[model samples]
Target chain A: MQHLLATHPRRRLFQLSPPATKPSREGVFFLPSIRIGLAVLALGGLGAGSLALAQEPPAPSPERSRELIRMVRQDCGSCHGLTLRGGLGSPLLPETLRDKPPDGLKHTILLGRPGTAMPPWKTFLNEAEADWIVAQLLRGFPEESK
Target chain B: MRKALRAWCWAILAFLPLLAWSAEPTLRGTGDLGVIIERSAGRVLIVSTSSNSIISKVEGLGDLSHASVVFSRDARYAYVFGRDGGLSKVDILRGTLEKRIVQGGNSIGGAISQNGRLVAVANYEPGGLKVFTADTLEPVADIPAAYGDNKLSKVVGIADLPGDRFIYSLFDADQIWIADLRDPKAPKVEKFSNIGKAPYDGLVTPDSRHYMAGLFGEDGIALLDTWQPEQGVKRILANYGRGEEKLPVYKMPHLRGWAVAGHQVYLPAIGRHEVLVADTIHWKETARIAVRGQPVFVVARPDGRQVWVNFAFPDNGFVQVIDTLSGKIVQTLEPGKAVLHLEFTPRGETVWASARDDHKVLIYDTASFAKLAELPADSPSGIFFTSRAHRIGF
Candidate 1:
């Protein structure tokens, strides 16, 4: 059964990278030094001290991430085009979703809009997973890689 | 020596027609040909159902992730409605795309008129129904599904009715419209509003008399009798959720497949794991047969003896066949992963199922429940046979 997480925001500072250290209770496993460097590179003027205080939610295993990508590509592609350019459903492309808040998008993914054809994915995905999906959709969802 | 060589050549020429006739005497018929949509690859595999083999692959049709196909009246050409709004006319015998045009920004599906003179496309992006001539793919008429302060509604479940008419439902508008294209130049439309909430998809009965649209927001199906339009739309199986908290749907159930066996019609119940069987005489609910997962395509065989079902997302791997005679699950076969679509032979002797993850179309004997053959494909989704050319609202 899929689990749902609370809507509390967990700031994911960097991209999905293999951690050199053991995972923590908060699910932040990447090396602090590397995380800080990448965060600085990504956020431009963000300070390392503030980044250190940011918490990251537990990330899906690499295997599960692959499954999510395939699901988004094929299953979600049924309505949203395989390219995320949209068909019966609205476009999930980065350019279209960039103006939308990531949290709102995550909620939409978890709990679908009531009157629309977009069905809720919460039955098969959790809040963290939905959050990751929204982040990916904002940064351009990855292609299905076998 | 030259005269002797010329005599031998003349003898060979005299028997050339006989040799050719002996090799392939019968003319090729389009009846045994079919097309399979390879979703992610933007290509379609033209296959021969008689040999259960892939004839050729036609490529460059854009963004086929949600593509659907309709056959020409002659069954020689397949008109593919791509999600990217690319309308392509492909000649199956020649294994080539005869013509293609981006009729809209995003399209859901389309249908061919009764006379086969026009093709109507249901678009989502521009929110309208665009009709074109089948021969040249030229624009004939454009009908915008406009509602409420000049806003356009997405058109879904567009199917051709008898007498050169086209029927479709508007998703956002909760309405069904029938366009009379008897004269392709000037089309007349009749509309029925407030039928139900979110008519996701629709289908016409095998006899081409009734058009039913599946409601997404509500628990019923909005059905219209084409023969009696003055009666308006009627709701069947309303509030089927039974006052219980409904389960979240992973994928929207499809109503495009007409599964009317004898007098009973099989429809997938939204947010439920059962196929609701209803009587066609009065359109009343008869029974609900529990099945695996949310039913996607509850399609009946050509003869309407057995109804085949595939599920959504997680339960998509298994396919169940229902014996219409007894209303029981006759066989449950795990064909492969992500079985997106299924199509039966023109005679209903064999059924072909596409496994997107497995990258192959599995052919099964509908009677003996045995595997017949397998053909390779790239993320195959919808398997359409040219036999659809003769059927109404295919």
Candidate 2:
């Protein structure tokens, strides 16, 4: 169980400012799916962070894949802009990040490279969750477009 | 403990999709000084000055998505205007919603009359200006017009003057209509060709001599001398393009405003992190103060001594306070989530803000400009004070 920790409006507002948009989508501020998951992790407890990693939509099961699409729209919609079209981050669809392997995707999620707004989620997620998130990216939300 | 963590992860996986499906991106507008407004909790919020960790929130106002707030002539009452077509007259001194009257119809904004005896609300549904006796809050009249061919025919801004005096803008039609209210019961209206664009936001001077409307596409704000409608209107200044062209990489031209105060006008350049200040007296470009991120709103202090600007960038949503005289950003407050609209107390002592990212209205102390408390707001657009003039039995 997670303790109800009181959130300080000033501190987090200053430190964890949400990126307005994705710098990649032709300068439109859009958020990627993984980033949306990471933002939710920040709002959750230490266990929730791991939970986010584990629940990283696009489960091996079909039911989970449907949910992954929802996560991309809702959780990632804040800084990513609505529609998951990509704002401040690169496009997640295969066409956008083509030729990249799952390990490459996992590496980016786990050890988020420096010199970029991306943050390392190694501490927040276990290996399983990272892989699951990668699976959805590979499959793309078109499989479950609303 | 490890087992417990594992189980929790399992549970989260089950509900992750549902949770993500409902979350929405927060919207904020930077106003006058260091003020911001957004939908948080369930009320309209206002945070003034920068030093606050939390902003003061006014609850039970309305949906932030379809509502807006404006000040009375005296800046004593903040009229919370909503889409259900209602206005929540709030008393800033008493910290309460004085009264809630069904006002406006998909209206652009609300205005108080010159004598403060009556209040007028613009509604989009029926596309007309609704007048109410300020004191009784009774529907006095439904001023109709030939709305033209506007697809979104909501009255955008309103200014009350002398001689059956009132002026309002229609968004879809891109026109400004003047109504002579010398006799509140029967008024005469004359519509003019819009100087620039539609959906313009403007303010009437304290003396009610002129109305200044800010255009979105035009490079600057426009002025209409309401004193004599027959003399026609004057385009005070236009083509206020972004001054910086040296760094093609960094140069951007912007000329637009969300709100105006006294003789000073404040607006944001979408391409830059700064708000431009214009002097209504000289009617010339005055100054531009750099802000943190994306600026959406600008509002002025009651006394017009200070102007605050808020940002929209997640981290860029800090508040910047400017000394009106010098036109320089003097203090910067890191209130989370760029602000949209903010309001000041009667005495101008406290500042309240609405935050979208933080999901709450954070209040701050004006003295030290520090955060004090947080109030739950649904979608606080902008903060406004109650009408000191309304209390006199309007």
Candidate 3:
């Protein structure tokens, strides 16, 4: 680990959602943002410094209901339109996850799926927050939640 | 009613990552690779495939029904390439699907260049390779393949090596293709003659010096020198079937999925339930050890000590485990029903698998080699989990 760190190149690109909206990448395969660091490291096989680029939560209150809607909006909207309608990601606007209980919903949110595009987020969210969002999703998200 | 339920499920899971990941903890690579694991009594499947050592999950993403997945070049971005060509690219760092690009036609396999310049999608039905600009998400070029040439050819897989080029395997056509995307605007397509009757799958060594081609119709692998692609070191049979009589015209005996790690090449053969080995240095046939049945896909560990194999269709659901050193089947994991794909984390700690009909992504302990847990995926195929998860949608 230290070997890679000492040799690691500093990737200037930042996160996957780099400042540039077009999001050019290192190649057709690498996500643009992270590759900046990797490519610099991969340069001459010098493989160096490791870095993780995201914010973790204990999200401040907008209430659990509000956060859930935000989560839904972020997750569903990221690919499907933020409207939660449907795009590459299937539609989620209150119809899909409505039937599953808050518990089951939390499971889906924290544990990213294996075969599908959906990844687990237990590391990204606390159980309580995941549940909170599911509950609010089961019911409704007030405009204030947004 | 079911439609509505399904819709809500998608909505809720989709949104949680947005809220959660936007608020995830900062994680840096500690020189350790991320892997897939199950938590909370196996209900949650966490994939630490992002640059950040965190996971982004979606509810019902691993429902055990059936699911498909695809990953960008570095595994930072993953797309659930689903039925009807549905694609959802995820943010591994955030553990969310941020973009979904619904392709008009059916795509089977895709490859991303090291520079993030191109994403070549191997499409079925339409029978051609569709090239897209990874950065702009625009159609760069669509190379029409000879799929229905007397129905003799069907493009199966596409691979993007270190440089700005790619190699594709044609199903029935005793041929392979190398497309040069030097200009991005004008791609120079070149056909590399096949050494066997049917070249199913192949892999490019990390150095991009040689391409190990697998012949499903023939009884072994064809070792092609990428430098002189038009020519070859000729065919290096993995020694499948009795003696070297070559396969009958109608038979598909080889059945290998080719994959490379660092320097070594792994060839998974169905006939022997063994993984054929080759020294990537010399590109010579090394050894072959038997594993479980019908091993289709082969994935090598980061250090190249082991190669994980996934079996499809028959053989009743098993992941034939191969030991690289001995070139033998170490164990067979029974995941059950139409297992399509297999991959390990960067650190080679966990193994993630997806079953086509089961609609589930099964998690296994790489160290313990146990059936740990499962996640729900929606008609997923060609699964991949990057250490860095970008938000993907579609």
Q: List, residue by residue over A48-71, the lDDT tens digit for candidate 1.
A: 322232234444776787788889
**Consecutive 10-residue window with the lowest summed lDDT within model 2 chain B:** B246-255
Best by DockQ: 1
TM-score winner, 2 or 3:
2
Instruction: Note the clash tally of each candidate.
Output: 0, 72, 108
Give me the runs in candidate 3 sitting further than 4 Å from their true place.
A1-146, B1-46, B49-76, B79-83, B86-88, B92-104, B146-153, B243-264, B281-284, B335-338, B355-360, B370-382, B387-394
* Candidate 3 structure quality by residue, lDDT tens digits, A35-125: 3433453332222221221221233353444444544553343333333333333444333444445567678778754434355667547
For each candidate, give the interface RMSD after superposing the true interface residues on Cα.
7.6, 14.4, 18.7
What is the model-wide C-alpha lDDT for candidate 1?
A: 0.84
Alpha-carbon TM-score of each model against the true structure = 0.86, 0.56, 0.55
Native-to-model Cα distance after best TM-score fit, residue A24 in candidate 2, in Å: 34
Question: What lDDT tens digits, residue by residue, belong to model 3 across residues B108-218?
Answer: 356666566676676543456777766545778877777443452446545665457877777656677788887778888877664676565566565556666677655
Candidate 2 docks with a DockQ of 0.02
Q: lDDT of each prediction vs. the true structure?
A: 0.84, 0.53, 0.52
Q: Model 2: residues >4 Å from true position, as ranges? A: A1-146, B1-66, B69-79, B87-105, B135-138, B145-152, B162-164, B242-264, B270-272, B313-316, B365-367, B372-379, B387-394
